[model samples]
Target: MLVTERTLAREIAPAVERSLPGVEVLAVEMLSPSRFCVYVDHPEGVDHALCARVTQLLDDYRASYTIDVSSPGVERPLRKPAHFRAAVGQEVQIRTATPLAGKKRFRGAVVAADERHLRLAAGDEAVDIPYEAIVRGNLIDEGQVQP
Candidate 1:
């Protein structure tokens, strides 16, 4: 039987949610054959204790592979519609499956987002990108001043 990354996420997400009711499973990525990364968050915030609890809950599944529990961090990935909605008014970087406005990559502030598409203000230009077309999206941490 082949257990893919999605399967692992589906199996583990419930257990994690059950153990920590308020915790949200942001993403599950397979970094290598034996290493998996789990990104989680809570309304209050993620801390060492929360990470430890998640690790403890996933002990059984860890027998065959390594699990690294972590917070989403500054550059949090936007994977779902809800994530995009939450990111409104924040700087974002998006890569579409195909070019939308003569380009595949876009970086700007998300002005609005809905179930179907999101509006991004890239300087003087505003681009509307549909949810299905987004291959990857992440919030840009603007607090770090660039030199």
Candidate 2:
């Protein structure tokens, strides 16, 4: 079996942690044979300018390797139910592997959720989608970030 870039990245995380404290390492996926993507984050109240400086440091040493840096947005995105629960009252973008009501994607405000489903409202219409039916979902940021 072939090991994924994410797997390789996971293996390398401990080393990274030793060098960058308090940075949230989200994922490391291979973009090509030599290129890799690194997703990272820090606490909400941390200084973003300093975070960018550290991202640059990571990129600098690995000059030969392509590094894409970014932070999680509004939907931050739900990889699990806990993520969904953490994002109540936020807008989100949901995509399903199979079409729902003829469409495979939906965007709306997340009004509520239970063990089995999530309630989303787009304008005045509220829809209930089974938790199992959601392939991936991200919380969207509706407001501008203050600098």
Task: Give the number of the best model, judged by lDDT.
Answer: 1
In candidate 2, the residue pairs with backbone N, CA or C atoms under 3 Å apart (3 or more residues apart, or in different chains) clash, namely 74-139, 75-138, 75-139, 75-140
For candidate 1, lDDT tens digit of each residue in 25-123?
877767888888888999999999999999999999788889999999998978678999999999899988789989999999999999999999988
Candidate 2 Cα outliers beyond 4 Å, as residue runs? 1-38, 44-67, 73-75, 114-117, 130-136, 144-147
Give one digit per residue, the lDDT tens place, for model 2 in 1-147. 015553555554555556678765554556777676555567653356745655566664375576665565443646446656776788888877578767878788788887777888878888887866775677776674222
Per-model TM-score on C-alpha atoms: 0.76, 0.53
True-structure RMSD for candidate 2: 6.2
RMSD of each: 3.4, 6.2
Candidates in order have lDDT scores of 0.86, 0.64
- TM for candidate 2 is 0.53
Clashing pairs in 1: none
